[model samples]
Target: MSAQPESVTTPARSWFDSEDAPGRRDLETCIHCGLCLTACPTYRELKIEPDSPRGRLYLMRGLNEGRIAPSDPLVEHLDNCLGCRACETVCPAGVPYGRLLEETRGQLDRRRATRETPMRALGRWTLRHVVPRRERMHVIADLLRLGQWSPIAALMRSDWARRLLPPFAIQGFAMTPPLEPRDARSLERVAPRLPAGARMEATEAALVFLPAGTAKTRVWFFTSCVMEVMFPRVNHEAVRLLVLAGCRVEVPRAQTCCGALHAHAGLRREARVLARTNVAAFADAGYDFVVHDSAGCGATLRECGHLLDDGPDAERAARFAAITRDLSQVLAAVGLPDAPASLRSPRDPSRPLRVAYHDPCHLAHGQGVRAEPRALLRRLPGADVVDLANADWCCGSAGVYNLTHPVMADAQLEKKLDTVERAAPDVVVASNPGCLLHMRRGAAARGLDVRMAHIAEVLGEAYPAPEMARAPAR
Candidate 1:
């Protein structure tokens, strides 16, 4: 394939003019230590300076100085970056690489009216129209589910599948049952609630169960757009485990897509519009807290406030963001009251299942939620949590990077898969949907049997027998 075409627009006067204040500050903070170069997956894979964070920073500087146009090969190198922000973790100057990269990408999108190719256009169209629209995505997801059982599914088992229908095949393999529709009364009845005195005396509650008007204390679970349609079991188990932990859970009807896909893809206007809709949807839910299972959604929701320009909507966005928490962080803070008694002595006492935890770049580098998920995993009976080498390295699944930069993404993913395989773990647990999806595809491509699961699903397996009820709230 031809190299992506060079930019037609004139380069901005300076990085200062090209970027927002935060971007300029981050770019200025770069000490050029090259520490980030080693941690960057693309840099390591290609062994090219330009693919590294330091090299990309220089490119950004050049773009800002009008030394290179927005469509230059240098800019394309910047575009190929995974944006995993693993570089920021080790940056001695504490440069805000994540914010800087995002700002730069957003600015580039703004200046360029059209994409370079048809595939990019099609990808963006699907993400904006099909993925965000729950109905359309669900329809496609159902077809994928059926396809998994058909003879053509064997076609999906080949290397050609990776080249032909990569995204769909990946989704097909990770398929889980769709969420069960919940009514208002069932939500309240099944939700975990604080004891009357507990509610009155406590300064905080675990979560404000926002089941679409149902009284279930379990919560209003935001299964996420992709997780709901593709990997419902993760969200289902998350809800089941939370309810068992004495947290009321509800799946709020008002809860919608988290808009991370759109935001990351540079559809800022669409992202903000969705953010505003979500703000209004949950505005009066009267829940003490909002919990999300997917780390990607959790992080995006937490930053929804940033999506809005200055206005009342911006203030509301901030408020909504504050209440959202990741499932592991929330459960660890609150403590699970009714954890399975059997878990007191884990299942495989003789040889506790050796498991490796791949830290999703979003969870580790984006939200600083590194320890909580690990802590929760360690609590599982007979489970040995092994840390892979370079635990903070990106898995090359920075949102849709695998689709947009498949060659670079595959090289990075291959390295990650090698690390995990060498550890010889019985399973691999990752917190974010993107990580799980990307890792699973990589593992399958290599014919590896490392099981991939969300932290919530793993915890759910430990819930005591006589699974929790789904009663309507009184």
Candidate 2:
């Protein structure tokens, strides 16, 4: 009988048996130093132990060791976290709070089969089916644009109509900017507007742009999902700035979404799938660095290697992550080109542009890119850049957190809006798409007149086509 296979006995499986469970070692790394408490937006607002980083680490430890159950209160505490990774920025012991929270949420998602509320179900379905695909995003953006431009928008904006919908849905619609007409949104249609001096070359079906002078470096642009659909203008401007800086910029249409939203929502499986797809898309494309304008997307792209560290695609993912760069970081490295003379004195020749810059949490904390954006902002001709207090604090967008947790998101948004109001900036610049959307909504809701724009948009304005500058003189 072969000794009955040695009568082997295996250990019983727990609810947290999945690979998504928090690493016990990473959890132990937290020294409960509390340095991250003040840096935490939720801790600063709620002033609670459970909401703080150290407190969350303790909860994670208890759950990992099976000392605690996945109770309603514990799950709520974890869900309340923005996953902005701001805690990672200040943790002296280098606790991997973001990874711990994400993995813990993944395990919680697997364990709680009965917890799927209608809203939550809808969110998951959309994330699984819609987000990673570029075409679906365009279709959704079109539908939204149609509603906004039609009488449907006014009807939905009414208080009674808004009450009938989910709060996040209402807030999301209110936050969106009017979309570009379909035909005008294509990159082909937009690129022709570049200055006469600009030169564009093609490589392996990717668009490469070089300044009038010799190219200093080559860069590949990671065109984001929402960026292409909703904010095509910003993408165009970013391209212009890169070409102006003597970069041989390449735009590979094969690139898709960075899967930041998937990771943030604890859909690690889906995130990994998208990460692999991105690896395949950019694998053969040759470039020194991959550039992204949105801070949230850039941060996630930089972590792709870590996301797929142990998988078959590990080496490729690591290489891709190594080359990813935020737009400001790359621009600052190559040197910020001088603004066109026309932009120098557009408002008042005597006074520089009174600009207030809001730091995106992902850029400031997640990627340590605080100095790069600020440096680029200051380089604009005649820009009197003023610092906003608590500028690095979360603007409450937190990648759809405003939709999921309106109350907490509002508190932070209101605080940020107040600071902008006091500064009285002619233009409030945000480097992340979510921050721009949230801040714009906050400013609009409060009847504030401050114009909000992406940092690239502001820089693009400074380097207008030569024809535009000569138009007035002619």
Judge candidate 2 at residue 311 and give its lDDT.
89
Per-residue lDDT tens digits for candidate 2, residues 279-395, read 887886467888999888888888899889888999999999998889988899998656764344345567667788898988988888888878887877777799899888899
Report the C-alpha displacement of residue 202, candidate 1, in angstroms: 27
lDDT of 1 by residue, 1-474 (tens): 776556544444663342232355567788888998888887877789998999988877776566766666756777778878788888899887766666666666666723567766776788778877877876776666666675757776667876777564355354333223323112232334322222211113223433232333433467688777666656656765665555656455665788887777666667777788778776755665677888788778887877664667987788888887888877887676544532221234557667788888877877788888888888877677888986677778778777667777777788888899889776778888888878887887789867777787666655632342232100
Query: Clash totals for all models, in order?
Result: 36, 0
TM-score of each: 0.80, 0.92
Q: In terms of TM-score, how similar is model 1 to the real structure?
A: 0.80
Off by over 4 Å in 1: 1-23, 113-115, 155-220, 341-350, 464-474
Deviation of model 1 at 187, angstroms = 9.7
Alpha carbon lDDT of residue 401, candidate 2?
93
Off by over 4 Å in 2: 1-15, 201-204, 342-350, 466-474
* Model 1, backbone clash pairs (residues 3+ apart or across chains), number: 36
